[model samples]
Target: MVRYLILRTLIFVGCLALTWLLGLRDREEQLLAVVIAAVASLVISAVVLKPFRQQASADIAERVDRRVERKREKAARSDEAVEDAELRRPAGDVDEGGSDSDFR
Candidate 1:
């Protein structure tokens, strides 16, 4: 992520400099220069930074998948614990004559 961000920043700065050198250096043309630089950087990065962007995206996806797997494992462990507890309870502890809500 950091690598991608730094590279993108460099591209923007390069584009900004290029725009300035291309006759948009006047104070009144500052906004135009920035807009052009931004667009140019975006296009350039889309082509030049494709690999880095894909790598960052894949990294993020992998992290999310790992988190989801961990959550699933935790839920499974909790379910097993509940099942084990249920098994350990005395079968006669429940009143056969009443619904579960009777105790609540």
Candidate 2:
């Protein structure tokens, strides 16, 4: 993530520098220079940074999958513990029906 951000910043700075060199900085409208530089940087970075973006996305997806897997395993273990507790209980203590007859 840090590497990607650094690379992106470099691209933006490069574009801004190029725009300034191309006489945009001499224009009366300073905002125009900034806007043009930003747009140019955005377009170039979209193409140049595709691989880094994909890698970041994949990393995030893998992390999420691992977290989900851990949660599922924890839930499964909890369910198994409940099942084990039910099995360890006395059979006579189990009530299959909601009636007072079972206690009698």
Candidate 3:
């Protein structure tokens, strides 16, 4: 894990260094681009890889337990998602028929 982070950070810095060495006379934008790319990569890695890493640390049995718990919670809440009462309310009040009152 430590090595992976180091390697990724090194790559990010390397890009910045290379751009500078290659004489990007307008390096302000070039460096900013690298910073943006690095931040985006970090955000994506955090969202995607971080969760998977936690799962990887656990034994198979533990992982399965966590997974089954998640599934059960998801299944329990499944009905409420479609049962949002406001949306299910009658549309009679909405007047989608486009009568004369629409122009008024």
Candidate 4:
């Protein structure tokens, strides 16, 4: 991801520099030059950086899958702990009277 970002940034800077070198910076419509440069860079990057973008996306998806799996495992462990605790409780500890003092 970082490499892709750096590559994209470099492409944009290169386009911007090229536009500036072509006397766009001194033109009265300087914003037009910036816009043109941005569009050009975006198009070029979309084509040239396709593989990098795909790789980054795949990496992100893998990370998300791992996170979800971890969460599921943690939840399963928590449920097991609760069940174990209930199983370990004495049968005589039942609140037959349903009184608040049982908690105390």
Candidate 5:
């Protein structure tokens, strides 16, 4: 954003200088000065505004990514916890015919 500001400021100053120089020529009309200034201002405003808007969009994307990652991590942790609990549980009580023979 700071770089964009500097670049836009340079452009504005350069355009204003050019306008001033052009106005000095005998053939140029005074309206040319106004036109140049207006065009310069419009261009500078657009140039300056572009990066800030882009940065804002990037910031939003970063936030969304962070939120998604946190959700995924939390989900994974919850699933792991449930799996651990399941693992710690004892086997179900069931009677098999000839349990001693089965063990043998």
Candidate 6:
């Protein structure tokens, strides 16, 4: 991701420099120059940075998958613990009171 950002920045700067060199240095032309540079950089990066983009995407996906797996494992462990506690409770114990919501 860092590499992709750096490369994309370089491409934008290069395009901006090229536009300035082509006579867009004046204040009035600077905006146009920036717009053109941005568009050109976007197009260039989309084509040239495909691999980097893919790698970054894969990295993000892997991170998300790992996080989800960790959450799933945690939930499974919690459920197992609850089940175990339930099994250890006295079978003769019964709730004869009102619903818990009544306390609230």
C-alpha local distance difference test of each model: 0.92, 0.84, 0.64, 0.90, 0.72, 0.94
Candidate with maximal TM-score: 1
Winner by TM-score between candidate 6 and candidate 5: 6
Q: In model 3, which regions exceed 4 Å deviation? A: 25-104
Q: Estimated TM-score per prediction?
A: 0.91, 0.82, 0.31, 0.86, 0.46, 0.88
- The model with the greater TM-score, 3 or 6, is 6
Full ranking by TM-score: 1, 6, 4, 2, 5, 3
Cα misplacement distance, residue 103 of candidate 4 (Å):
5.3
List residue ranges in candidate 4 displaced over 4 A: 98-104
lDDT of the structure predicted as candidate 2 = 0.84
- 1-104 in candidate 2: lDDT tens per residue? 77889998898888788878888766585677788878988898899999999999999999999999999999999999999987876757745675334375
Task: Name the runs in model 1 displaced over 4 angstroms.
Answer: 99-104
lDDT for model 6, please.
0.94
Q: How well does model 4 score by local distance difference test?
A: 0.90
Candidate 1 lDDT over 1-104, as tens digits, reads 99999999999999999998899989999999999999999999999999999999999999999999999999999999999988987766766665443375
- How high a TM-score does candidate 6 get? 0.88
Candidate 2 residue runs with Cα over 4 Å from true position: 26-28, 94-104
The alpha-carbon deviation from the true structure for residue 74 of candidate 4, after best TM-score superposition, in angstroms, is 0.8
Best by lDDT: 6
Model 5, stretches more than 4 Å misplaced?
1-46, 93-104
- Total backbone collisions, model 6: 0
Write the number of the candidate with greater lDDT, choosing between 4 and 5.
Answer: 4
- Backbone clash count for every predicted candidate, in the order shown: 0, 0, 0, 0, 0, 0
Clashing pairs in 5: none
Tens-digit lDDT string for candidate 5 (65-104): 9999999999999999999986865565324663433244
Residue 32 lDDT (model 6): 100
Which is the winner by TM-score between candidate 1 and candidate 4? 1
Expressed as tens digits, the lDDT of each residue in 1-104 for candidate 6 is 99999999999999999999999999899999999999999999999999999999999999999999999999999999999987986775555663333254
Note each model's CA RMSD in angstroms.
1.8, 3.5, 14.0, 2.2, 10.6, 3.1
